[model samples]
Each structure stands twice: as C-alpha cells, then as structure tokens.
Target: MRHRLLALAAGTALLATTACGGQDSPSQEDGELTPLTAGVIPIVDVAPVHLGVEQGIFEAHGIDLTLESSSGGAAIVPGVVSGEFDLGFSNMVSLIIAREQGLPLTTLTNGVTSTGEQGADLGGVFVSGDSDIESAADLESARVAINTLSNIGDTTVRQSVRVAGGDPTGIEFVELPFPDMPAALETGQVDAVWAVEPFGTVIRQAGGREIASNFVDTDPDLSVAAYFTSEQRLAEDPELFASLTAALEESLAYAQDHPDAVREVMTSYTEIDQSVVDALILPRFPSEIDRDSVQTLADLMLEDGVIDAEADLDGLYR
Candidate 1:
C-alpha cells in the first residue's frame, strides 16, 4: 500500500524567492551577526542543536540562532525549502524524497548515525508487556504506529518486516506523535510503534517489549538525521553558513564526549525524563557532511518508490 504526503512545490517556490539571493562576498564583520531561523524536532537525534544552544556555541560564533520546534521531518523540510527557516534538522529519507521532488535544498552538516545496537537505532519498535507478539514475524498482521509515514521510521520498520520473512504489506501503519505512542500502546490502540530516542527508552522502562531493532535488521550505516538549508541561503551567505556549521560541529563533539551535558540541555526542550536520556545510546555525530552516506538513503528511497526518481545528490551538500 502507498501513502501520499503533502506536496512541497508551493512551499519550495516561496523559499526559493525569499531565501535565495545573488551571491555575495563573505561577510567581513565578525561580531555583528544576522539572526538565523532554524527548525528542529525535539528528538535525541538533535542533541547537537540543543547542546549548542545551552553551551552558547552559536553566540560564540556570532550567530543569533532562533529555534522553532517542528512536528517532524515532514514539517521541517518544507520550512527550509520555503525560507521560513534558514536551516533545519531532517532525516536522510525525508531529504532524499524532497530532493527527488526538485526542492533546492542542501545538507549543511551531518546530525547522527545509528549504531545498530539492541537499544539503539531500530530499537524503537515496542509491544505491550503482556502482548503475545514476541518476534518480528508475529507483528505481520498487527497494527504498528510510527511517528510519521514515508520517513525513516516507516522505511526501517518495513525493511525489518521483510528481513523476517513477513509480508510488510500485511501490516497496518498508523501515524501517532512520539509523545502519545506509549499511551497508545498501553491501551492496545496499536500493537507496536517505531519510535526513537527517549520514547523508545521510555516504553522499555515502562515494561513494553521490544520485538526488533532497526539497526540490527536494516542497513547499519544509515544516517538518522542532519542539518539542512536552502541552497540559496548558502550561496548568498557562505560566511553565515560556515559559522553555523562550525558551531554545530563543536556542539556535536561536545555531545559525544559529554552525554550528561546533552541530557541537561535536552531537559530544557523535551519532556523526556532524565533517566531515559541517561539510558539511551546517544547517536554518532559527524562534523562534515558525507555524500556517500546520503546517497545510500536516496538509493533506498528509489528502490522503495518513496521517491519518484533518483536524486542528484552530488551537489546537494553545502
């Protein structure tokens, strides 16, 4: 079964007009900075952004960063494409789909890479403690909930089901926000849910059963999320883009070495308990963008028909 998401053509066109400008020389003044509107989902994958803000990295780099919380990658992609946001966080799957549809966006930096561990990556598919679904195959005809359709969660779950020799098409996928997934599962509204970070850890702590993990079943090197912006913004203000990237890279490094610091920052933005943050396997943070890693996502989307055509990913990095 195919699911159609809201198209981004109109929003893309608007972003092109508002965010793009004729190339300008790099800014000379260092202290005075322009405000950048950034969109992000409040998942653990975006710990860098949160850490950067908490640690004043952006301020040190002369960037007045304004963060806007979005529903998911679906909302964030459009926000970046339409110039509503200068840069935003997005998953590889969503970015590939948008590029295929002709959105002139580019990845500014890498966010996180999944390490296929039992409690990491595809570790989000959870069942109630008393549920009979003990394995991936058992979820064949069961109802599953994902944060969003056609994004990483959906793709990973489908691939996991396929690997288990189950017909992915036989399952029903429902969309539920991350915050509500635990309740939905507890009440038997859904048999399993593909969540990430704190939510996944939360369910497990609450006695939910994890049937399978995406990292163990799907491709291991898959990138979970990254920082992306409109190409026009980069072309017009290379200095600003570089500053943002540098600050983010620094924050990414800090997040890896200081998971406790990241947890403190996360408390400011997410409702996830501090205990969950401590237990979660923090995602890998890369400073530079990796075209090959992103290309893998595009290839997978093309094979899955999530994207209408193959994307020209070579020049999609800033």
Candidate 2:
C-alpha cells in the first residue's frame, strides 16, 4: 500500500508572531532574548508550545517568539532551510529523511508521542461505520485517502496496513486534506482516510468506524513530532538554541499539568470544538530529543527508499 501521508511560509514585512499574539523583536540582551520564528500546525500535538506562551514561559525566558501556523511539514522544512523560520515542528521521520537528503536540519526538542490509546487524538485511518472494512486487512485493494503523499499520515497508514497482513502496495491512495476526508468518504471519492486530530475525531463523532490507529500499531515511544532548526541557526547562535529548548521545556511542563488551560488558550486559534478538545488524546510531551527513537524512524525511511542515505546521528544532541 502506498501510504499517503498528508500533511509554512514566511515573509517579513513579516514579524513572526508567537501563539501569544505578540510581535518578535531582536534582542540586545546577549543570551537573554532572541527573535525567533517558529512554525506549528494548529493541532493538539502542539498544545505545549501554546501552553508555554499562555503561561508566559517564553516571555519569562526573554525570548521574543513568533509562531506561524503551517499546513504541513512540507512547508515547515523549507522555511527552516531558507532561514525564514528559525525552528519549526517536524516529524522525526521527515526530518531524518530531509537531513539525509542534505537539508541541514537537526532536531532541537522532542514534542509529542502518540500511543494507541491516544491514537484518535493524534490521527488515524477510518472507514465509514457501514463500510465493509472491519479491520486494516480489509483495506487491501481498497481505495484510501491521505492528507498528502510521502508524509507522516501516509507512512503511518502504510505501516498499519502491513502489520495487519495487507500489502500496502495493493491499495489505491488518494490525496486529500483532513477537513475534506469525511465528505470524500461519503461521496465515494475514497473508502477511508488517514488523518489526525479534529478530522479523526469528527469522523468518529459522525459515525465513521476506525479500522486501525497508527499510534496503536506503531510504538508509543516513537517521536511523532519535534522542533527542528538549521545548522546555520545553531552555529550563529548556540545560546539562542538553548533558550528555545528551555522555553519549550517550560511549556511542556505546564501543558502536561494543565491540559484544560492549554485547551482554553487554543480555542482562539483553532476551530476544533471545546468539547472535542476536552476529549482528545493528548500527546506525551518530552522536552529533550530521544536519539534512539528518532533513529528508528530514520531506519524506516531508509527501508522505504524515502532517502538516499542514513542520517548521521552523531552530535545530534546538545
């Protein structure tokens, strides 16, 4: 099955805006503050970053942060590489693949971990409740929808199908966005879709049945999301990089302790219902990168022929 994984831009005249609704300004305080541009998708996976902003953690650390919402990692990586974004959210697999392909990016922080229990919260593959797809195996020779090709959603679903004894290569994969999956499924544009967050929850709420959850099939310890920065940013400002980590660490701590508060803050940005927000499975927020977990994803990409080389994992940590 060719997994269709779905899932940034910058300009100045563009003063990067953090989720906190403030403009970032360059700092003169040496290591005290830095004007940083960060990108995120407006999903629960990024709740901690928003929590950090809501709780004043980033501000407390003297960091002027600007956060731009991106549609997918495709946009985020280019922004980071082009110096438009100092750091952005990226999947471990995507980052490793990009780096092996010479994108000059490195993981700065571990963001969210997806588990089977939290599968619906992050995203998953779903079939209409009345459909004949009772298990992932039913997806064989079936039509499937993905947010994008060669992205996290696609790769995740591919793995899920394989584990269920279905040939991932045997399925037809169509590209669609998360918001449109429900209609697509109803209209027979596709039989199923691999999605995250709101869309997954929406499908279930509307009577769609989940055939498989990537989180359940995939290990929870897998690093699904992370913050990444370019080698240029690290070299010019190691202290700034450290500040970003510290800020995110503070955010992660706050988010884990106050899920309600994080949800409240997010309502202003996303259209996801407050009720859905409360019910969603929250991702585990580990502040530091786990090299081993990341390496596993890198190895998978290699097996899939997504990258030309293995990621050089040395010196990948601070």
Top candidate (lDDT): 1
Residues 142-242, candidate 1, lDDT per residue (tens digit)? Answer: 89998877777777777777777777767788999998999999999998988777888889889997887864566566667788887877777787788
Worst 10 residues of 2 by lDDT: 1-10
Q: Backbone clashes per model, in order?
A: 2, 12
Superposing all C-alpha atoms, what RMSD in Å does each candidate have to the true structure? 2.7, 4.9
**How do the residues 159-181 of candidate 2 rate in per-residue lDDT, one tens digit apiece?**
78888888777778887867788
Q: What is the C-alpha lDDT of each candidate?
A: 0.76, 0.70
Residue 11 local lDDT, model 1 = 28
Task: Provide the lDDT at 30 for model 1.
Answer: 46
> Which sections of candidate 1 miss by over 4 Å?
1-12, 15-27, 289-293
Could you give me the TM-score of model 1 versus the true structure? 0.90
Any idea what lDDT model 1 has?
Answer: 0.76
